[model samples]
Target: MNIIQNPDSTSLKRTIEQGTADQRIAVLDIINEVRKNGDAAIKAYTEKLDRVSLRSFLVTEEEVEQAYKEINEELLTIIQEAACNIRDFHSRQKRESWMTTQENGTILGQKYTPLDAVGLYVPGGLAAYPSSVLMNVIPAQVAGVKRIVIASPPQENGYLPAGVLVAARELGIREIYKMGGAQAIAGLAYGTETIEKVDKITGPGNIYVALAKREVFGHVSIDMIAGPSEIVVLADDTAKAAEVAADLLSQAEHDERASSVLVTTSLSLAREVKKEVYKQLEPLPKSVIARSSIESYGAIYVTDTLDHAIDIVNELAPEHLEIMTEDPMSLLGRIRHAGAIFLGRYSSEPIGDYFAGPNHVLPTNGTARFSSPLNVDDFMKKSSIISYSQQAMLENGRKVAAFARLEGLEAHARAVELRLEDL
Candidate 1:
């Protein structure tokens, strides 16, 4: 990791902005083809991109049963436990419809309704994340989503990952599709013969999947167009260099474009953490990817003060922020922009990613500045409830009509006037 002395804010901003125009164009073409040709286009892209011609897109019940037997009992136990933790955490975020009534015979409220069906895109092949299955599916389940299906790329052997299948089965999700990429997204947005159109699509994927989500956003609700994973560790002299280095590498190993940064007040700690990162990278199985990420996007900014460090963190609005100072909680109130926060040295980023109750699907590419982590609310919709008695309408209708007339909307004015005339 390179050490910089007070880097410029613009340079920091540039690291998180990802995706290319050509990539967008390619994804658009794939989406258009899938929209026009439907199931045939999905098969062609799956064969061409994933190198496997799938006979059937849906996973059978027998296959799901075999997946349970294929994985060991020990792993299954862990997945179940993790699912419970995720469910318990998200259950707290569930909301109920509320109403307020007035003596004037008017009622106003908001109704919370779960989405009818949702599509989950899980990346398969080399990238297999069963944790993602738990994180994305459980929230939808808590929100009472009726139909949930997963679309993952099939391997060269034309089978889904046993871990992913096992996780989905644990959540009672049966509809697993053997498809991926932009075509899978297209199929989900505009249904094919095999796949049903979903109201919303969630989970993370590569650039093509991200761009496809961007294209089909209006047609179907999407969680967010997630970028590469990123982590920013705000450490002080009290922080252990080795622990900070490990946390940074955890995110860096996710992808070659992943950004790992350390903003600290202590120059000595920054230098030590830099050396520790190099030592830890050598032993990692994904050292090449981590090394590439660290060299290109990772950096250690040694600020003159802790306040300055916090300022830089807010400016970056990282997906994950770790406060490794004397009192990590003391800084929590000051952190205005972060997808998820790890309070102390022990609260590693992976805890939230895997076993911890909180959702790991977070906003990336500085989206934490305005957006938020994926939750039960993402799978739910809200409708405004309005009811007016005859007396209420008789008192308010003329005012509403006059306002509509002022806006030159005669149709809106007449609608209110008609109700008023009946009253």
Candidate 2:
């Protein structure tokens, strides 16, 4: 990792940003072909992208039941516990369709209602993220969404991972489809003869899957246009360099494009953390990917003051941010941007990914500034509820009419005027 003493802010943004126009165009091209050809396009894309040839694209109830018997029971327990925690936390986020009455008998308020059905795409990439399944599905369940469907590619033996299936079963989500990538997203968004059309789609995938979601947004709602994984640690002299480096490499191992950066105020602390990152990176399973990520996208930038460190973090708007300074709370008010902020050494990023109560499906590639982590809100829709008595309409009718006419909407004005004409 290169040590830049007060590096340029623009350089940081250009380095870590994801989701460019070219990527968007490529994804759109794929989505268009899939939209045109339907199942045939899905078959071709699956074979081309995942290198798997499938005879069928659906996982039957019999198969799902058999998977439970095949896998060990111990792992199932862990998935169950995690599911309960996720479910409990999200259940708290449940909202109700509401209405309120004015003193003059005018009824008005916004109504919160869950989507009828939703689809989730769990990527069976380098590793199967079963935790992701729970993170995405339980929120929909909490939001009282009626039907929750999930789609993922099968392994070489044409079977889904036990952990994933187990997670789904725990959530009572029996709708599992044996399809993935852009095709899986297409299946969810447009609906196949066998698969049901969903009101929205959520979960994570590769660039192609993200692009497919971007294209299908208007047809059906989606989580976000996710990008590559990233982590930024804002550590000072008090931080344990070893733990910081370990957390950095954890995200790095995801892929070469993955990024891990550390900004601190101490030069000695910077050197120690750099050495610690290498020491930790040496004996790792995915060292090849991690090493390249740290060298190419990772860095140890030294800032003169804590404010400067906060500035860099805000500009980056990293997906995962860890603050390990002496007074981590001091910087809390200062941090204006980031997907999920990890405070102090104890609040590591992995906790949020697995055991922690918060949702781990965060916005990436500088989207933290605008977007938020997936929650019950993603699965629900809102409708404004309005009801006014005759007297109430007469009281506010003139204001409503003039306001409508100011926008050159005579019909809108007349609608209100007609309602109050008898008054």
Candidate 3:
């Protein structure tokens, strides 16, 4: 990992600006081809990229049952428990339609409604992420989405991972498809012969999937155009270098494009953690990926003060921020942006990704600036409802008519005036 000081280095800034106009437009170009050619184009891309020939894109119910049966009892139990926790937590976020009635016979309220159906594009890159399956589907289930669909690439043996099937089943999501990448997203957006079009699509994928979501936005709602995984640790003199190194490596092992950074005021600890990262990297199963990610995007920035460390964190707006410092809670109110915050040395990024009750489907790159982690609200809609009685219209009709006339909307003014005449 490269070590540097604050504010001047361009590593984080360049990451935000990495994707260019040509790369972006090329993604859109691929999406347009997929939309025009539909399943045929998707099959071609699957063969071109994944080097896999598909017998069928859709998986049968019997296949899901087989996968469930094949999954180990222990892993199944874990998925069930995680799903329960996720469901229990997100259930708290469920909101209902409500109205307020006034003495003047006027009623106003915002009604919450669940999207009828949603598609989940599960990425088959690096590894099959069962935790992501839980994060994406559980909230939609909690929001009462009637039908939930999932699309993932098949293994070389023409099989979906047993863990993924088990996770889907645990969340009451029955529809499963053996499709992935931008093609899967395209299939979800524009309904294929076998796949039903969805109101929204949620889940993480490669750059292709991200671009496909961006292209299909007007056709169907999407979670966000997520970037590579990243985590930033803000530790102090009180923190442990080894623990910090392990946490950083957890995110680094995700992909070659992933980033793991440590911001601290302790120069000695920064050096210690940098050494620990190399020691830990040697033993990691995905050592090559982790090494590449760290070498390319990792950093250790030493600040003169803790407050200065925080300023850098806010500027980065990392997907995951860990405060492995003394009195971690004291700085909670100071952070303005982060997809998820893990406090203290014991807390790590993967905790939120797997067993933690919080959603792990967070906004990547610097999107923590505005976008939020996937939540129950992603699967719901809010409607504004207003009803006015004759008396209520008569009481305030002139203000309404005058306001419309001020905008030169004479027809809108007349519509309100004609109703007031009944008074």
Candidate 4:
């Protein structure tokens, strides 16, 4: 880790992986093949890429039972408890259809409707994240989404990870698919023989999966084009160097492209955190990845004051922001952008990732400035309600026609005028 007196905009800017031209072309090819061949194309890709041949992509009840046996009762209990927390948190975000009456005899309102079906793409191979399952599924379930599906790549043994399966089972998510990468995205976006199409897709994957989401966006709704994991620690002199360093490395180990930054007012704390980051990274199992991330993207900025540090944080709009200052709550009003904020040292970033009940799937790579964390609202759509009484239509219909004609839409004007004449 490097410590600088005052870092500039370029130093703070983090880059996300945008797939290469070849990868994009490959993704398009896979999508097109799936659209044309459906199940056959998916099977071919699974065999070629995953090195496993399968006649069916659906996970059978027998396999789900086997997955339960593979995971111990203690870990299963933990996953169930996490699911309850997630469900409870998202339940508060549930919305109901509402209407308001006006003096002019018009009813105006909004109707909230849950999406019929949604597909969650959990990453497989190298590692399996049961946490991702709890974070993504619980919100949709809370929103009353009837059909929730899980799609993950199968290992060479032709089975999804035990943790992944166990988590899905705990959530009562029975529709599981053994597919991965662009093909899994394609299958979810466009219906195949075994896998039905979904109204929306959410979850995270590699560069290929991200690109596939971009390609299939308009066809079906998507959460967001997520980037690599990121963390920005806004600390002051009161913050401990070891605790801050450990928190930063928690995100850096996620990927070589992951970013971990520290913005502080005290120069002493900055140097201490920089030293502590290296000392902690030495023994990490993913030290090579974390070290690469730290050397390439990590930085410690020593600002003249806490206000200046907060200004820099707003400018970066990082995915995860940790405030380890003396009074973390006091700075809450100043923070304008962050996917998730961890206040105080005890409220570490991992708390939100696994068990704290907030969705771990968040906007990344400066996207927090405009987007938001996944919640129940993401699984629901809104429809505007409009009912104008006869008297109300007679009063506003002419103005509506005039406004439509102002845009040179003759039919739109006539449509309103025709109703007005009847009124």
Candidate 5:
């Protein structure tokens, strides 16, 4: 990892992947085909891209049962327990519709409605993410979303990963589909004869999937255009080098584009962590990928003070921020921009990824400055409720009309005036 005394903004910025023109064109073609042909286009794309032909996209009960047999009982139990943890955590985020009646007989409030249906795009086959399944689905389910669908690309053997199937089954989600890429996204967004259109699409995917989500933004809701994984550790002299190095590597192994950075006040700690990072990298199975990530995007920034380090972390706005200073909680109020904040050495990044019960789907690539993690709110919609009483309307209707006409919206002013005239 590169060790620098003070890095500038140019050193921190990473280019967000927006896909190439050819990829965008390809995604558009796929989406149009799905719109024109529906199920046939999905089958064609599945056969061409996934190298598997299927008459049906739905995963049957028999396949799900077989998936259970393939997974060991212990793993199933762990998945079940993890699901409970996630459910318990997200249940705290559930909201109910609320209204407030004013003294003037006006009712003003907000109504929260869970989306009718949602499509979860799980990476398929060898790249299956069972944790993602738990993170994305449990929140939507908690939000009272009625129909939750799962879409995954099938392996060459014409089956989704057993772990993914088991995770979905644990959550009682049976509407699993064996499709992937932009085609699956299109099928979920536009609807096919076999697959129903979802109100929102959530989960991670490749460049094509990201591009497909961009194309279908107006047609349906999407989570966000997620970038590569990132981790920023704000530590001090009191922090251990080995633990810091290990936490950095946890995100590096995700992809070559992933970033692992350390901001510390102690120069000695930075030097020690740089050495420990390479030492730990030698035996990692994904060393090649991790090494590429570490060498290209990883760095250790040594600041003059802990406050300076905090400033750098806020500027970076990382996806995952771990505070390893002596007084981690004291600095929480200073941190304004982290998708997730893990305190203390024991609260590692992976704990939130799997068992710690927070949604792992977070904004990446500095988006934490303005975005947030995937939660129950992402699967729900909000409606503004306004019931104006005759007295209230008589009081404020002329003000409303003048305000509307001030904006040159004559119809808006007349609508309120007509209502007032009727009263």
Candidate 6:
């Protein structure tokens, strides 16, 4: 990992840019082809990219039941526990319709409505993630979305992973499709003979999938276009060097482009953590990827004070922030930008990623500055409700008509005038 005394503002800005125009064009072509060819395009692309030919895409109830028998009882128990935790947390974020009535007999309110159907894209094959299944599906269930469909790439054997199937079945989601990449996104957005068009799509995928989501956004609602995973550790002398090093490597192992950075006031601790990272990396199974990530994007920035470290964190707006200090909670209010905040030495990044109730699908590539983590609200929509009594319209109609005429919208003025003509 690179060690810098203090990085300038320009260098910080350059690290967060995610995708290129060429990538966008490539994904756009894939979306267009899928739109034109429909189910045939999806099958062709699945064969070319995933190296599999599929006669059918949907996972049957028999397959789901068989998956439960394939996996161990221990893992099944763990997945159930995680799902319960996720459901409990998101249930708190559920909203209710509300109304207010005035003495003039006018009623105003807001109605919360869940989307009719939602498409969830889960990475398949060797990169299967049951945690993602729980995180994505539970929130939609809490929001009362009835139709939840899943799209995942098929393995070499033309089947989804047992763990992935088990997770979806546990959530009572049986509509699993054997497709992935940009084509899966297209099928979800535009619909094919086998797949139904969904109102909203949510999940994380590679660069192609991200670009496809960007292309089909207006046609169908989507969650944020996520970038590579990133983590920023803010520490002081009180933090343990070994624990911090392990946490940094946890995110670094995600991908070759994933970022793991440490900003601290203690220079000696920074040096020690750097050494610990090297020691921990030697035995990791994904050492090559983690090493590349650490060498290219990882850094240790030594600041003058903890306040300076916090300032750097806010500027970076990392997806995950860990504060390891004498009093971790004391610095909570000082943090203004971060998708998920982990405090103290014990609160590592993976705790929130897997077991904790909070959603792991967070904003990436500095998007935490303005956006937020995926929640129950992502699957829901809101509509304004207004009811006007005859007396109320008679009392205010002419004023509305005069204001509309001032804006040169004569039709709007006439609409109000018609309501008040009898008065």
lDDT of 4 by residue, 332-394 (tens): 999999999999989999999999898999999789999999999999999999999888888
Off by over 4 Å in 5: 13-15, 419-423
What tens digits encode model 5's per-residue C-alpha lDDT throughout 1-69? Answer: 778887766677453767889999999999999999999999999999988999898999999999999
What are the models' TM-scores? 0.97, 0.94, 0.95, 0.97, 0.96, 0.97
* Shift in Å, residue 231, candidate 4: 0.3
lDDT of 1: 0.91
Predicted candidate 2 versus true structure: per-residue lDDT over 1-423, tens digit per residue: 888899777568333434678877776776777677777776777777777776677777877788788768788887787777788788888777778887898889888888999999888844677898899998988888899899998776667887788778877888888788777887888876677789899998887787788789999999998888889999889998889889999899987888899989998988988999899888999999999888888888899998888889998888999999888988898888899999998998998898777899999888899999899999988999888898888788999999999999999999999878778
TM-score of candidate 2 relative to the true fold: 0.94
lDDT of each: 0.91, 0.84, 0.85, 0.92, 0.92, 0.91
TM-score of 3: 0.95
Between prediction 4 and prediction 6, which has the larger lDDT? 4
Model 6 worst lDDT window (10 residues): 9-18
What overall lDDT, based on C-alpha atoms, would model 4 receive against the true structure? 0.92
lDDT of 3 by residue, 1-423 (tens): 777866554545325424667767866766777778877877777776677787676777888889878988898888888877888888898888999999988999999999999999888733778887999988988898899999998776667887887788777777888878777888888886777799999988877777778878999999988788889999999998899999999988988889899999999999999999999999899999999999998999988988888988998898999998889999999999899999987787777888878898888778898989899999999999999987888888999999999999999999999988777
The runs of at least 3 residues in candidate 3 whose Cα sits more than 4 Å from the true structure, single-residue gaps closed, are: 6-14, 17-30
Candidate 1: 10-residue stretch with minimal lDDT:
10-19
Residues 331-421, model 1: lDDT tens digits = 9999999999999878999999999899999999888999999999999999999999888998889999999999999999999998777
TM-score of 6: 0.97
In candidate 3, what residue range of length 10 has the lowest lDDT sum? 9-18
Q: Which TM-score value belongs to model 4?
A: 0.97
lDDT of 5: 0.92
Off by over 4 Å in 6: 13-18
Q: Residue-pair clashes per candidate, as listed?
A: 0, 0, 0, 0, 0, 0
